[model samples]
Target: MDYRYKVVDLFSGAGGLSLGFLQTKKYDIKVAFENSPYMQETYKKNHTGVEVQGDVCAADYADIVRRYGKIDVVIGGPPCQGFSNANRQKNHAISQNNKLVKQYLRAILELQPKAFVMENVSMLKSEVHRFYMEKGDEEIVKRCNIPVKDTFLHLLDGAFLFDGAIDIVKDENLINQYLWPEADYFELNVIYKSAKNISKMINALDHHKKKLESLIETYTNLKGDDHIAEEARKAFSAIKAYYDGTLPADEIKSKIEPSVMIQRMLSKAQEIFQNNIIVDEYVQGSDLAAKIRSFAVYDYLKDILTAPENNYVIYSDVLCAADYGAPQKRMRFVVIGIKRDISEKIALPKGSYDADEYRTVKDAIGDLEDIKPVYTLAEDKQGIVLPKAENLSELASTLRDSPVLHNHIVTKTTDTALERFRALKPGQNFHCLDDSLKTNTYTDAKRTQNTIYQRLKYDEPSGTVVNVRKSMWIHPEHDRAISIREAARLQTFPDSFVFYGSKDKQYQQVGNAVPPIMAKAIAKKLAKILSKKRNADAKKNCTKGNGRQSHKRNSQHKHVAYPQH
Candidate 1:
């Protein structure tokens, strides 16, 4: 009990997870790695004794061991925004964000911590969330039984490049007669020819600059071409004229401007560009389809960590933060791995609180309701005084540990935002607002999530706390955004633990944090398993030295060995 286990936190954001383990009083966070400058400042300010490294990708695990001795536990929540179901971008395959998961696993592989915990979005369990197969991943992909199929790799909006089979329609009349009218087809033909001619002229003139310059200089005197808009034709001619000192520099801008007709043509060209599809090969799939390579992220993680060489027995499950007393229903995928040599048993922590017993918004932040929040990051040396309220809830009382309060900052609301905020009731969001109030807001307001502009209900736990400031989370009763401190309270951070950064960044730090209450439960469970192993090892060593222990006593506490793949 006197010994404190050494731990290293990777992708540590504002030291939330680290704080939870530190609260158990059984672990010492020796080192932490965070990439954001603001997050680094916040982490360093809170975790003063721990060394803070920059990027998790640049972390050298062997060097970490050499400097801090053996790291008993490794814990981190690698960035999972790319894996989020809400992401609508085209960079889903092999994005830079997804690689950090591998970096986290690399730490366990090199540092070989007795126990390591990885937390990420619950969507990580989905089959759609996958990483593109890289070189040397074929064997592992097949071994994991991960489903793989050929999919067109998107290059841009509605544009894709596939290295697989494809069919091309050869009937020209099918497009000209059925797809578009005669006028539309003629306009497209003119645009295509004009663009082709312009490109050919530009390339042919490259080697005959003097003649091209002379021709361009006299173009203003020539009759306008019927094939393209005058503006489009002038733009091509003005380019050489401007460089040859024939056209006034100031006039070049006006001459090169595209007319409405040309603009329409350019818009059509953009659609064509977006519709463009390219593939490396056109062969159809068969038994040869086995050559099409790709792998799901979770499959690869399980394959590598559970291998005999890695010596880990890992268990993964979706855990709700509310189950651990946080006033938010944030669900995260948690993976806990123990060194197989340390113990064959894999025990994840069971929730201590059920649905009826879960903490609510009022229990977490009801006390700070009337207090006016500041709109800036400047700290008051005297610190804002908190009002004394009687019979504060346990969660609220635990959060009011600091004598002075900080980070009670809110975003300045506009009149438009204020009107929308006032219209919402507890448990209502943007969707509840009147149609007149929703105008000119989101690009597509109807498709907006229910979480946007959410007003928390006093009796219920809040939804996942994203950047409340960005989401403009309305206060339960007040017609204003929830303060950064309020959001942090929902995540179970004590008042004394201050966040350092811009107001927006501070809100982001809070949103991205693992609820400390949940983290503490996991940490406590790990500590118990690790402590049991340590005691068992100690008893065996003593028994060997003395040669006095009976075989029956040893057999009663024998470690069970499980089969590893």
Candidate 2:
């Protein structure tokens, strides 16, 4: 009646996902499983009450089930090697046969919680290689048997339904043989022939279809193998059909026409796809809107159709840390699953600040009086230390040859260079480097003024913080690279969230982590949903009897122990 749920986090690296869900207030993370000792230690340090287990694969899921009767949600990201685009490029077979992905799937099947949220890089949607390899002479022969226009429509329709929904018919032969049989084709031909304008669109569609077919053939012959040829052939043919007006007229009129609504949808879709941080690779399609909508809708159906009444709701624009008041730009994919039997509309949390009132780097860490730069030789030595004044004997003596010291030789600035350094502000890049002092690195041979590194300004947001040391993230004014704390602050990591490992490891963790603010935002939404469900359950039970009312009050009391704020 109190509407509280327990969560089990798998692959809980630094408890980012766990933090997000806990922030939601509706669920309490009872136990979390992380394989890395470093990560586990960090998780334990930050989360005092929750149990942190090691090695999810080694840990007994059955034992967990026994300990925590029924887990309301199982949330975490599996190591997405198999579905990654990089893996696919290296070895398609190996990538496709990724054991970890299958293991993750097995875990989900075994756990059978009310619902689960699986997040991964977008490369999982890469065009299946088998689809491309089969686009050869055999496909051409198949197209010749069916009217090209009908074939195009069938393919698009199939893609829309299959990739866009969970209820896709798995048997390819059944789909090919029964769904779009020859009779259906003749029916479509008759309809096309009867309508004049529709016939014109059909003709245009046919022309593009033929052209695509030819291209597929050419590509296939050049490769001298049928592998992936069919897929390539089909994918191109589908695109041609959509663009050339061969797709169903009704669908086009309703959704694809260049109307204001369609335009806005397209624009939004483009923005979503473009800004998607997880998947940065090639996508072959004219309309990104169609693809994103298809995927989102498909995921919704997959999660919702057979789910319990209150188990799931579709959420979007779930901001990562940078989107809220955090100075760092960490974005992530968020999908929440709530039990439907509970009556509640799970609303997302309001942002901590308005867009104009966002927090900056200075606001996050400027008050930390000890602002000395330190590096690390060993993984364990990484941490924030206090800085000392320039002329102090103790300060100069402490600057030894450990990896934890900032060792940039202070530049003796000429009048011109000094003026340039003074003039440059935070967030400004090497472009502000004085013309006279510029030199080019080998990597920037073709570019002008390439060998310039600048210090960060206090007021502005830091550039993308990456693990690679010789890239864009140099200090704006200082000759040295930005300190670990500086990088963490930029990423909106709270001063309290300590990172473990050496300097390099710290950088990697900071760079790789989901911004805390982003995690907090997602958590807020989850909390609101849980609260609503709890109140609704309380009301429902009150009608049943006074006994149930007592249970509801007890649950509410338990919830108060873990304050939402």
Candidate 3:
């Protein structure tokens, strides 16, 4: 039997990254961790013989070694929704999703895998993406020499809100310090209100639950208000779970903190409008600390991972999925790390295709153009017969390899959606629609992204495949939404791989996945590096006297090929 490197996948959503490593035929994915039950089902079914665990936060590295033996590689793209550019409400607090990046690092530090790969949103490379210094991070921050800065929280908005107050100031630059007083008071007031509100909610759980239930019941009997009903139902369910003591402690905190923080911020801002003069003395006191010292996430990662104790050679760069032959222009920041003892060098995977050779929408899903998708969830396996074509694109051929297709289901559309879908031409979006057609769709129709209500152009690659079902992404030539399978194909997922969940969950799984084609390129590169290291170790073992190995495996290497990108 050929030697297959053992692999462990963290945050293994829908097994897209693992699928890529599997495609290399050089990796044996022994275990995976995914928190979502739907994703866990899909991953378990697809990646047979792999142990699927839940909640990477609660994972025990020692137990894993005892059961699965030594792991060779660790690969995963932790949740990056917190780092997405679309998130407008960036704040000083590190989001729970953002904290998963540190958990990925924890896996590396504990498992001490020969090589590890991590991927996240391209925005992570920006200097603006950082972590606020917590009390625990102070010692590490100082020891790592990571640069820290004092950022005035919740003051950026005050710059505009207090523009009138600013014009009266003699020095234009003094406006920031002048407004700092108001910002500090604003933050303190919000904090106070939030804490009070949380206590009230916890104390009056029955009252709030009854209120949410009443609102949900009222909306259930109404028409043209499904979205509002859904929101209410979600809230009621959460409150019910919390009251029943079924919700996790972290979930309870997460549910309460964000909503309380945002609501209190807005309500307090209005209550304290122009009332800062009375509290100016309080703001200047030690209680109101407006300036928060923080360090960049990228700098911290570099400093900690490259430290002498970790002994890892790490490389990071932004990689485009289209550059790796996927029909989507999705860009992600990728980090590859190799044990320094295994090799003193490390490099990121180079893209094989440039702009001209990028795959198009037609190349990806053109074969499925004639097949009508089911309007609702049906059987797990559906028969798919492709139309006869003389020249099938390589991507399309790979996508059609399965004997049967699954997830070829589209969300049923309303008349308004069908109208908007028909009105859009190839490459057109919601902005091109008439004002009447845009009603009740978004909070701000003008601010709606062009990606929403988009009609795919056959000749061009699609943009990042977000939850296209929510976007209402239309077909290129047909007057319907793109099916789940089409979106998967655009993400370079072969038809043989089936998604197991509701239509919405299936779409989310596809959107959240790292394109297998891009993942395969990365896995192949790592395989070569590991294989070469193994060969070098074997050679050194022979050279040692009496054929005795001096040290444990992966501990002997002093030099190896690690070409820079």
For model 3, name the residue pairs that clash.
none
- lDDT string, candidate 2, 1-565, tens digits: 4466777887777775676566556677888887777778778886789988886667677787798777767777665443222231111222322334434545555666665565544343232211111123234324323211110101112222223211112223322322222332232233233233554545544554545444444433433233123333343344445656686643433322122121122222232333331222223243221221111222322343334432444443344454566664444444445555543334445566665655555554454324445444342244433444344322122222122322211223455445555655666545766554443222232353333444555565444455524343445445455565556556555445566654555666556555555665665656555566667778877778887888999999989977865
Residue-by-residue lDDT tens digits, candidate 1, 347-408: 67999899999899999999888778887766544568886788899999999998778999
lDDT of 3 by residue, 1-565 (tens): 7679999999999999999999999999988999999999999989999999999999999899998899999999876444222233433223557678788889888998988999888978676676656657778888878888764333223212322322222223433322223443233223233333454434444444454444434433434433322332343355456657897323554433333333323332222232221112112132221345666777887888888888788999999999999999999999899989888898978899989999999999888888888876764455455556657899888778776767888988899899999899999999999988987556457888989999999999999999999999999999999999999999999988989888899999999999999999999999999999898888877788334554533244433323332
Task: Give lDDT per model, in order.
Answer: 0.73, 0.47, 0.73
Worst 10 residues of 1 by lDDT: 161-170
* Model 3 segments more than 4 A misplaced: 81-93, 155-289, 379-389, 545-565
Model 2, C-alpha of 88: deviation from truth (Å): 8.9
- What is residue 209's positional error in candidate 2, in angstroms? 53
lDDT score, candidate 3, position 344: 88
**Between candidates 1 and 2, the lDDT winner:** 1
Q: Residue 457 CA error for candidate 2 (Å)?
A: 4.1
- CA lDDT of 316 in candidate 2? 37
